[model samples]
Target: MALPDPNTSWPPKPWDEAYKVYAESETWRVGDADAIHEFYRGERPAATHRRDGELYEGGVVGWVSSKFWGRPVPPGQNRTRLHVPAPADVASLASASVFSNPPELRFTDKQSKNTIDRLELIGNSDQAHSTFNTMGELKSVFGASVLVSEWDTEIADHVWLSAYGADVALPEFRKGKLVAVTLWTEYRDGNEYYRHLERHAVGAIEHALYLGTADKIGQRIPLQDRDETAYLATLVNENSVILTGIDRLTASYNMNLPTWAWRKKGALANAGRSDFAQLYPLFDALDEAYSSWMRDLKLGAAKAVVPQAFLETLGRGRGASFDIDRELFVGLNTPGNPDGDKIEQVQFEIRTEEHEATTTELWRMIYRTAGLGTRSVDKDTGRQLTATGELLQDDDKEATRGKKILYDKRAIAEQLAVALELDGKLFAGKGGGQFAPPEVRFPDSAQVDPEKQARTIQYLSAAGAISVWQSVKMFNPDWDDTAVGAEVNRILAEKRAAAAMVPDPATFDGGDPTQDPNNPDNQGGNPDGGQ
Candidate 1:
């Protein structure tokens, strides 16, 4: 099929219509994406809800609900509530667990010498580790992230890899395979609109369209008001075109497994669902409870009682007339007035124990919903657990959620396969060799006790239940197969050297020492003496 013309109609009438439908379907999801972004930025929905005049009726004036009227009512204050660190904590924990150490790439054929180098080149080039780390964080925040790979001639290695959030790239799927992808980019130069689009369709040449509301001389104008000549010139001669590109077609892949939706069976179902989203309600509740507790404390601390007569004598300025730190004196027209002798202070106590308990419970709920164990918090005091304990708790949970990490491993393997295929097709002349789909290895998330594991491996090795190589591997999980083989060779060399140092009895005289000791050499004492 011929490519669509930019001059006749860009974005096509049907595409525009479809985009409208797609955008409409994604309205709520877009909102969810925004919320997820806010969450990552430490902004909680509770902050918005607790803002004055938002969910409340008459702003701060009508905040006195009947149930809270008698109590110290906390008015809805902007930015007063603490946005619980649940989102950030969960994201950090997940990212740390997923990529605490860099992943390993293994090839099925051990003789494929270039496999490791190629994998390393791609992984280390273009800041891939940082990009992957960000992707892990994105997965925790937005439920998904995307990996985009392409060959750029201008780049140092010619392989360009990038990670994108869920907002910009849209994948079109046919059956289970990705058929096409649309990437959108926008920018502004002064008052001009610059929009670029790259549409990659399977088995077809990739198309690039750049539209700007500026003339050739850089005069700003409305897109529709631009003349036909200017538009046609912009379409044809303004940008570079590629007739042949890599054969794999799609340049991007969504790095998330589609196990669940943003919300359960709704318009936003297609959107990415975040673990933080599940704990949003808990965070909001905690914030509200803490805010109320603070308000009560403030009100209780400021509570005081004043006499009506004193107020009248001071002309309603009694508060300014008396110093709280000094003794207050009230004068009466009469010589001695017992009523003005003393003023009583109102006493009110805050149920701090109850507030602390409630806050602790909320924190526990947040950690639990985020897939962090309850022991993630201190069981006794409800404070954050120790770092080592937290890590252990995360490891336990990750062990149970091994399926999730496995999916990540598989997804990354598939992506690397695609990248390798593209590399072979486009950059094979640059010393990039073809490779089979490599096995991906993630760090062991269930590593509870390394010392105990090492001891167990040692015992097994001593018992001849496992090979020395296997024991070495168990002790050093980060070592690849080649490294393990090298280590085994090194140990064997050491053993041979040690054996060579000590001569056996049979080899002492260059003969079997166990042979008859009465022989001439064995009876040398008498034979040599007689000689």
Candidate 2:
């Protein structure tokens, strides 16, 4: 559905509805809504839960806590058990998925080469690659990343790309195209109501809503001080209104700032399901298992069985004097016996191997569900596996990740085309003609043996199967067709220059100055000089 007009309705219906939809979407995208918030604040869920008395309760007062409180154990002996791997792993995977290599933009039409170069220059000047990489990573975590492009006179380059997370921006689409976006920024200003500055394509609107109130329909809350720019006022006259506040009105100016959305998984019904959602169960299971394993290991090592006679000898009140220490020895008493026998210490073995196996399997599952494959964890040491192994291992993963990258690239390209078209009309005074869509080139994700690849290219070039320019391109994938052609011309020019400098054997003269020009050395030998 199209965006609701904010003028006639005062407040747009879609704005309120979209807010709820985005909130719920974000909740599902981040897995546990509360935990993900905590993560954003740099708090580990496992640590927070433990601190809040969720993981464990009470002090080290009972028999189990008393004996095992300070003793060394296999599992909880270190602080590793309290660590949560899901968030870090997810972030790492997300980073690796996008930032491993940079993307290339190619223009099919030679006439659009200047435009392509200008776009690339703008991207570099504004650090668009880094910004987009960060946005892609955010999409992996939050399920969606929205970006808006605008012309900024302040920047050296006139164009700029700004990235926003899914939390702040809400997009409305019509006929499979992004028509409008509503962005609301909330801040505190020493009032009961939180001030909000809502921006749309046409203009900016200012309003305030009550804090801590559910922003639902018919809340009876007063709208404090509504203000809008002249641009938005103009939109009310030009667009259609369905009585739902500012319906189908353009928010932005003639700029047509395109809103690009990059989703972790394409076209999901629940747009909020993040890349890490499916693996959350595995993370939870691993966390709980590690906690239990540590507890068991600690208790098992400190567990000791004592005879009642030994306790009686220490006396009822003096039993507290007995300290459990590695170097300390305790004497046990036998009835009617003068000699004291050594107490039999209870031996309990922690099933550390079993816990390790379970955790290994959980890690494998987490990696697999995250599309990282089971080889993500090393089989022998249970540590994270490196990505340098056989190409087959990462083939499927690269394919999946490549598809996402390509999808996002295409969406961004569409927005870029709009931006370019608008720039041509407004700045260049051209008739806003649409240029050919640029082709996006992503780096090969699969690992290739460079030596073997070079040999194959060499053989192909030598056998006349592929042109020298094609071989050069195969070896240097980063070079565009223009660059390849330039290099080829340069080589040909150098060869022509070298050929011009050399004397042709057919026109060569004899070393003897006296010899007749163009005559063979033997033909002129009969005269004064011998051949």
TM-score of each: 0.59, 0.55
Give candidate 1 misplaced runs (Cα > 4 Å): 1-79, 110-115, 124-126, 186-195, 203-244, 249-252, 255-272, 300-348, 379-396, 421-430, 446-531
What is candidate 2's lDDT per residue for 9-119, written digit by digit as tens?
A: 313443443344444335434455344334333322223323433334433212222221121133434532343556556655765666556566656666454565566
Residue 450 displacement in candidate 2 (angstroms): 7.3
What stretches of model 2 exceed 4 Å from their correct place? 1-83, 110-117, 150-157, 188-273, 300-347, 378-395, 419-436, 446-531
For candidate 2, the lDDT comes to 0.52
Backbone clashes counted, model 1: 1
Q: Give the per-residue lDDT digits (tens) of candidate 1, residues 1-531.
A: 133343444334333433333332233233343343333333222333354434445433343222111112244643333334555667767676667666776677763445456677776444666776777776666555566666655545546466665545555655545566666555665866454545556534343434444322122223334332233233332232333344555454544434353235332343344555555556557656786788668667845565554443445655444445655555565566765645678756887988988988887777776665666456578465566776676665776346557656655666676676566667664434444557777766533456557667877978989998888887887699999999999999999999889988874777664366756665655434464
- Range of the 10 consecutive residues with the lowest summed lDDT in candidate 2: 250-259
As a TM-score, model 1 comes out at 0.59
Backbone clash count, each prediction separately: 1, 12
